[model samples]
Target: MASMFRAASVAFFCILSIAVADAQPIKPSASTQGFHSRARLIGGGQQGEHWLAGIEITLDQGFKTYWRTPGDSGLPPRFDWSGSENVASTEIRWPAPKRHEDAAGVAYVYGKQAVIPVLVKPKDPTKPIRLVLALEYGVCKDICIPANADLTLDLSGADSERKAIEAALAKVPLLQKLGAQADLSILSIAPVAGDKPAFTVTIQAPPGTKPALFPEGPENWFFSASHPAEGDRFTVTIEEKPKDVSGPVPLHLTLVAGDKAVETEVSLDENGKPR
Candidate 1:
């Protein structure tokens, strides 16, 4: 799971693109080749059973970086931690990304500075762990510039990164159980009634929800432009059916509404309604 998380790209972007406990200021080394980036370990993360950590990317004024799924163009970030000690696995996660539209297309990105959170597990619960990270990412403006960062940290004592780490972690979208509801809800899904087997999802949200959604689907398939159809109603188009698949094609969505975000997964039948 950690390996996959480290490799998984979304825009919470380890492809998309910090913290401590009560907090000693653990300033990690900067990557000489890329944007200013370092590793951080949060003390007693969330439930207190595992350590929370991530990579921090600091972009200068007017510069931007891509998300895990960089909408149209841009490179995703990657993490390699084989140099660390006392490590078991790591789950790299992303905070919701802002939508950036350019002549290149629509790409998800972080404006100014970005702090990406990672969930870390140790090989020994009783011993300390040193996390070494080799990260690669891209920053853009008129043209895209590729960057790399190598950072390391030993988490044993001192926990001063809590505030920053928690702040970043809090931005991550909360995952709801299957078929559960939250501040957001999916109102409808239906087939496009064409040979493409495409579908449309209608979302019902509060007034001025300004919801921005991210799609998780199968390969060779993607989501089209999402726009407001009517008041508080928006539609997202899925391009095609799941290829080489069976039972049901499950689609996942992450909706970001200002400070609130929720993630949900649904399996739809041929008609596009959640089954």
Candidate 2:
């Protein structure tokens, strides 16, 4: 009886230790090339209000990452946090990306490192928040190499984490200003007769500025075969399908003024109507 009691005590203690270790939060590891990825929660998690979060990627020397729309080739990084508790919703707020063209193809990417801001809302602040980011991005040199990571972050009463997130969020506005701030006025959107329906987007930009417009949505709905006619006014021919006609589509316009770049989002009217 004495031996059995001792054995039971030992077993219980071992189980308790394992449980404690399992409950401890896990920190994400940076890439071997010194590419670190992290996420943190900022302010405003009270009651019904949403909080701000940041997902940051710090790249090493000679490494590059893709943008939301990676142009002809290259896959954009993806995030998956379906099992998070106390996280009502999460969204990625991307800065304007630059255009890159090489022998491989045309692509959009963020050189060096980038901090992607996100909005997070919690249904109940009392519960602990666990966010998992499963990211897959392509890094290019002469050829493209695919990289993936499963990054996990804790977002419950972490003041230090909040501060770091806020710092990252602070940079977003400045980055936007540096990238694309071209004020584009949509003059018209008209339909054309073809095997696939099409629409022409006529825009007016600031004098001495050449802006490139990229559709933010899926490629099947919005094709990029159109050419840009330069003048005081610029025109881009876009394919208009049933999928593209559901609602307004936002275009990320990047204007290059000398060596500087500015990005702006313009919404198009439905049914190819002038806006």
- Per-candidate local distance difference test: 0.68, 0.57
- Global lDDT for candidate 2? 0.57
lDDT of 2 by residue, 1-275 (tens): 99999999999999999999999865553222323322222332322365555666666566667877777677787877675667878877666566677787667777766667777777776677666666667776656677766565665444444555554554332224212324544444455555553545555556675545554443454445334554533344454435446546655554433234445455555543323
The C-alpha TM-scores of every prediction are 0.76, 0.61
Top model number, TM-score: 1
Clashes of each: 18, 7
| Candidate 2 residue pairs in clash (backbone atoms < 3 Å) | 179-261, 179-262, 179-263, 180-262, 180-263, 181-262, 181-263
* Model 2, C-alpha of 201: deviation from truth (Å): 2.8
Error of 1 at 38 (Å): 7.7
Superposed Cα deviation of residue 136, candidate 2 (Å): 1.7
Tens-digit lDDT string for candidate 1 (88-181):
9888778889877779877778877677877778888888788887778888887787786667776654556666767888998888654355
Please give the lDDT score at residue 264 for candidate 2.
46
